[model samples]
Structures are given as C-alpha cells and as structure tokens.
Target: MRADRLVSLVLLLRQRGRLSAATLARELEVSTRTVLRDIEALSAAGVPVYAERGRHGGFALLPGFQTELTGLNHDEALALLVAGSRRGAQVFGLGSALASAMLKVVDALPESYRNTAAGAAQRLLIDPETDLLARRSVAEEVPDTIVAEVRRAVFAGHKLRIRYAAADQAPKWRTVDPIGLVTARDQGYLLATRSGADRTYRLSRISAAQELAEPAQRPERVDLDRAWQERSARFRTGGDQVTVSVRVDPARRAHLVDTALTIGAEEPEVDGWLRLEAVFQDPRHAEWAVWQLATHAEVLAPQWLRASLRERATTLATRYDVPPGESRPSRASAAATSAATRTPDSTAPSK
Candidate 1:
C-alpha cells in the first residue's frame, strides 16, 4: 500500500507541478502526517521531490521529471474521462475514489495525449442537464451513511440488518444477505435475500441499517445482472397486471411499446396501423400512458380506461371552449381583452 501511495505521490507531483501537503493528504486519502512521511520516503529514494518552506509552499517534483507510468494512449484516456463524466461511481459513495483514480489516470497519460484527450472529453457530454428538449436527468439523493453501510455490506460479503419500508407497509427490520447494489433513474436499490426469498429495498426507504459481523448467507458468487433481471421479472408478473388492445399509427407503434409496461403481442392491421396487445401495471397506468399519444393511439378494449380517458378529454376541451355567440379570441384579441379587464389603478409597476 505504501509503495503504491508513494508511486501515486510521485506521479501526482510530476503532473501537477506542486500541491500542498493537505491537498496530497486529501487526494491520497491519508493524513497529513502520513503524507509527510511518504514525502520523506520519496526523497530518500532519490525521487527528486522537495518542499518549499514559504507560506505558498508544498511538495513538488524537479523540473523535467516524468513518471514511468505515462503509458495510456490518447483514446484510452478519453474513454476513462467520458466514463467518469457519467457519475455512476458516485452512486455507491465512490465519488472521491473515482476522482482520485481519475487524477492518477490523467497523470499516467502521455504528454502528447493529455490536452487532446481532455479537449475531446469536454466536447462530448454524458447525460447532459437538458437533453433533446428541456428534460433533465435528476440525481437521487441517498443518505451518505446509508449508502456507505450498504456498500460495505455488499462488498465485504456481510449480512445486513435493515429497517425497510415496503410499499403501503410499515417499516420492519429484516436480516438480508446483500447480493449487490443497483442504480436506476438515479435511485439506489439493494438486491438481497432473506431465507432464500428475494427481497429488494430501495436505498431511499432504508430508515436504518447495520452491517453484521457474520458473513452473508447467500451464494458464494453472484451474477448481479442475472439476479436483477430475475428479480425484475418476478416483480412484474406477481401483481394484477392489466392487458390492453390498442391500435397505433404505424409510425408511432414503437412509442407504444416503449411507454407500456410490456408488449404482450403485436399484429399488423390491413389499414397499416398496427394493433398491439400490451400489459400495463393497471387500468389507471394504462390510461396515463396511452394519453401521451393522443390521436395516434386508440385503446380498443378495457372499456373503463376508454371511459376515463374520454372523461379527461371532455373536461380539457370544455375548459378551453368558447361560449355560444362569442367569437374565438385570437392572440392579439386575448391580450387586449386581458388588458381591458385589468384594474384601472394598475398603472403602477407590475408585480
């Protein structure tokens, strides 16, 4: 560990030119005392490291010094930076560790690759704030303490005693062997088991957690991707899922499947519009999804959903409809009407 730390210290100084002892301590995840000792060790080993004594002083490597670790090509450096920009590593409380590792990676890149790799990464965006419209990716906030505990239990092969709140149920304590942690839609889920029964607890719903000293009770090795898929399939099929028959415009058929819980079947119609049999969580959920493709999608079965959607459409239309004997107001006419309706004393500055 010390060897690696010293090597990192050398590489950091080589790339950064100079960094304070506290800064090095933070980057290395060690105390300032440890940093000083490592500095001494590097200097003793003829690493050409030195510290200036002034107020603006810190550790530095001699000019012209370069680490042998500069081996990553430009493409490799760019790839790593792009992956880092996704912020996936931050989900499990690895934000600092990822940052430290990325610093080392940048330092290890060849000089010719450094600026170009950084520039290329800057030009590329991963999960930008506003994407293809005003839609944004929202990062879920899980308590740092909870995330740290869950991460430790998962990676250390320890059982976790968790107080979890399942849907519509009171919070209860359970001991589960953590299989892995998963992140979706910026939220974290812990996939675990209790007495061979599959259980998943959202990180946001964990009120309390304890990492057990005893080892986990699950299998020796886990294929997390396979486990997640299996759990997802069970959850989807366990409930009273609704099925709907719908006619979708040929151009918008893909959108139907994309928004539904799952596509149960698909058949082409002679009129060119495709008829899709889809499963949704429930009638209400089906209504909500189908409403998005108004005019482009027609729900054929589940009369209750059709009625509900019809009621909503009727209500919306009535709200904006013009009264009898009144001409439809154009934009300019609406603005003039609004101004005329204002209070006579409203010449004061607008609120």
Candidate 2:
C-alpha cells in the first residue's frame, strides 16, 4: 500500500509540477507528515525532487524528468479519463482507488496528450443525478462497510450472510453463495444463490453483511449477464403481472412504453393518438405509471384501473376547488395586501 502511495506521490509531482505538502496530503488522503516522509523517500531513491522556499513554496521534480509508462494513445487515454469520472467506483467503494488510478493514468500519458485529454474529459458529463426537469435521481445509499464486506466476499469466492429487509417484510438474516455484484441505473444488486436457488438482493436493503470463512458453493466460472437475464425473465413471467390497454398522446407514447414491462400491440388511433396494450408488474404499478402522463394517457381496459384513476383525480380536484367567494388571491393583490399591512417601522431598514 505504501509502495502504491509512494508511486502516486511521484506521479502527482510529475503531473502537477509543484504542490505543497498540505495539498499533497489532501489529495492522497494522508497527513502532511506522511507527505514529507514520502518526499524524503523519493529524494533518497535518486529522483531529482527538491523543495522551493518562502510562502509560495512547494516540492517539484526536475525539469525534463518523466516516467516511461506511456502505454495509452491519445483516444485511449481520453476514454479512460472520461470513464474514471463516472460514479460506478463510488457505488462499489472503490472511489479512492479510482482517484489514485486516474492520477496515474494522467501522469503516464505523453506530455503532449495529458492536458488536452484531461480538459476534454472535464468537458463531458455522464449519468448526472438530476434531469432537465430538475427532478433529482435518488441513488440508494449502501453503507461503505457493508459494501466493502459484500465486495470482498464476491471477489474472494466466499459465502456471505446478510440481514436484508425485503419490500413489505421484516429484516431477516440469510446466507447465500455469492455470485457477483451489479450496478444498474445507480442502484446496486448482489446476484447470489441460496440453497442452490438463484437470488438477487438489493444492496440498499442489506442492513448488515458478513463474509463467511467457508468458500461459496458455486461454479468455478459464471456468466453474470446471462444469469441476471434468466432471473429477470423468470421474475417478469412469474409475478402477478397486469396487462392494461391504454391510449396515449403521440408525443407521450414513448414515455408510457418506457415504464411498461412489455408492450403487446400498438396501433394508431383515429385522432392521432396511439392505442397499445401494456403490461405492468401489477395493478398498482399500472395505475401509477399511467397517472404520470396526466391527461396525455387514458386507461382503456382494466376498468378498475380507470375507476381508480378517476377517483384519485376527482379527490385531487375537489381538494383544490374553491367556493364562489373564496378564490385564491392573485399575486399582485397579495403584494398590495402585504404593503398595506406593513408599518413604517416594519418597512424601514435597521440602523
């Protein structure tokens, strides 16, 4: 670990030219004393590292000194820099390692490609946590310790025990043969097996985890993608799935399709709308998804869903309805009322 840190320290100096001990410590997540010690170690190893004096002083490497680690070309280096900017590392508790690796990648690039690649990567954004509608995407929070243990078990091919709280159920401890971890749409899942039966657990639902001493009872090699797909197929076909017929505005048809588990048949309506049969996880899921489209979507069949939506809409409308003389005040009227109610002292600036 110290060797990695020492190499990182040297790479930092090589990339950034001059950096104060405090800055190095902050970047490397260590003490200023550790940074100083690293500097001494680098100097003793015959690397031409020296310090500048005064308030604007720091450590720097000799001019023209570079490491022979340039194995990536221009596009390759840029791709890596951009990928390192993603949030997957944080999901797997590898954020620190990723940061260190990114530093090394940048430092290892040829001098001509380094700055441009880094700058270009900064210009691109990936998987932002919010959309243009200002709706924030909430990522499930998994405790770092829990994720670390789970990750260890998966990589080391050991059994894992977890106290998991499934939806609408009490937390229960279960032991599973760890298969692998997967992250999709900012959510983490552990694909494992219990009693030789495939099981998937959401990492956020895991309150606690322990890596067992026993090796996992699983195959030597696994195709995780195929496993997940098989499980998903079974889940979709086995659940209390509800099929609904709906007519959606042409513009919102894509939105409706995106939320459904599957679409059976789609045809254009006479009024330029689209009529389609969509399947959802359940009736409640069907109702909620159709409700999101507001007036742009209408439930055709599944009379119960239509009734439920009507009841909900009526309730909401009644809640916001006003009587004959109790209309909401306009903004201008409210502003005037506020001015009229204010006293001279209330409006005056404080001394």
Per lDDT, the best of the predicted structures is: 2
Worst 10-residue lDDT window, candidate 1: 70-79
Question: For all candidates, what are the clash counts?
Answer: 0, 0
lDDT of each model, Cα atoms only? Answer: 0.79, 0.84
TM-score of model 2 vs. true structure: 0.75
TM-score, per-candidate, Cα-based: 0.67, 0.75
lDDT of prediction 1: 0.79
Predicted candidate 2 versus true structure: per-residue lDDT over 3-112, tens digit per residue? 77887788888888899999999999899999999999989988899999989899999998877543444323433543643566566666566666678778767779
- Candidate 2, backbone clash total: 0
